[model samples]
Target chain A: MFKSSRFPIYYKGHPRMFVKDKPIFWWALKWVHARFIIRELTSVPVAFYAIILILQIRALSLGPEAYANFTNWLKTPLSLSLHVISFLFVIYHSVTWFNLAPKAIVIRIGKNRIPGLVITGLNYVAWAIFSVAIAWLFLNLDNLM
Target chain B: MKKSSEPFWWALFGAGGVISALFIPVILFIQGLAIPLGWIESPNYQHLYQLFGSPVTRLFLLALISLSLLHWAHRFRFTLYDGLQVKHLNVLIAIFCYGGAILGSLAAGYYLWLI
Candidate 1:
């Protein structure tokens, strides 16, 4: 499609329809490609949640009143629903990305390579560790009120 | 047809993708889910403020927000090109996407500093 157009007058005798390149939205053609596109789209919500975190920081700077207001905003049904959707999309992003870990990193043990499931499972294992550590820290914060 | 500097942005994209996948989800679960749903009590504002006061926290926050922005920039650039079929304004799109990310990162840093 980027090339300069080349054309012939249907070979001068028998007119034939010319095939064009797939439209830009070609991702719709397959489930794999569509899911890939959806993965790409997750960046929007990821950045969005980051913005909210930054806002939380700003509110933190302002003292409890501002933070309380931010919490109040978040407690609204609309904000809660948005967070739920964002959480789901974030999970989708994580699952797809983690699933691709095996492809991105080939683990070789001398002569034999690690099985794909083991490689992929390692990602989940690491995830579980980090998450549990964070959960423990978050849950056991003695100073939390 | 020519060699492009896409790999640089892509490196940032990949780093950001991994960071978000590994770390952001749990934070989302905590702030976006647990706190709101009362599965966990909201930590006192002072406690969180103290958490953010550390230089380490500031730096970690910097990495998280900056990489995520750059990730968005790179992805949004391709999204425009492929999804919307914007063929002619390539350079402008790159400038807008990456530049916007840079600006947003700086803003995040500034706010983080204030925090």
Candidate 2:
């Protein structure tokens, strides 16, 4: 729903063109832009989590003690809070991304155009399947390992 | 200018965005909420190391890291343009953003592959 502002002519049909320049914080004023700004902000945590994953890999490479310490460090209140916040942000990002997919992709079987909700629903289904698979892996880690 | 390669980058951004959106959150839930908060035991380090060492895991991690970085780059570029109203530095901004993603991705690959 993020949209550009519909700027009005400040001076009515002036011979010298007059433009109404919006403030930099204009995005905060509109609901759509506000959502858009939050979406853009989600990239920070996405990038952070990516780096965290890399660090996990690196800690693993360093061997058991390092990995244990890293894991322990992550359990701290500050880290947990950040994780929860980032998790919320990432989930929001995913839901919005799925919802927006219909805009980017269009499928037509003969004459009937597939509904956007159907497309979004299919994505959610796939996501649910994957989440379960990962959960299964996590739960069975003891046996698998 | 010839037709801007905006669509091409957008496709990459889209792919990255979708992949990260679907995968990252669940992992975050487990690591952030489950394991750390005592909802579940911590994962075995050796097993995790073995997983990380595997070719498939490496490939998945690489894709996750690189593509997500590219996604960030593309989004950040537009955020700067439309949100900040800084339209004059088009070529410079494009290069900086895309270049950073490429460089970060390469670094991720190198570290993941070498160590």
Judge the docking of candidate 1 as incorrect, acceptable, medium or high: medium
Error of 2 at B64 (Å): 1.1
Q: Distance (Å) between predicted and true CA of A121, model 1?
A: 1.9
**Tens digit of lDDT per residue, candidate 2, span A1-145?**
1223556444445655545567889998989989999998787788778878877777777778988888988989888889989998999999898999899889999999999999999999989998988888887776787
Query: Alpha carbon lDDT of residue A59, candidate 1?
Result: 88
Q: What DockQ results do all the predictions give, each relative to the true complex?
A: 0.60, 0.59
Residue A42 lDDT (model 1):
90
lDDT string for model 1 (B1-115, tens) is 9988988899999888888788788888888788888999876777778888779988988888888888888887898787766867888999998998898888888988898
Query: Local error of candidate 1 at A49, Å?
Result: 1.2
- Using Cα atoms with residue i matched to residue i, what is each candidate's TM-score against the true structure? 0.86, 0.87
lDDT of 1 by residue, A58-88 (tens): 8888889998999998888988888888888
Question: Alpha-carbon error at A60 in model 1, in Å?
Answer: 0.9
Off by over 4 Å in 2: A1-18, B89-92
Clashing pairs in 1: none
Please state the Cα-based DockQ of model 2 relative to the true two-chain complex.
0.59
- Candidate 2 lDDT at B41 equals 81
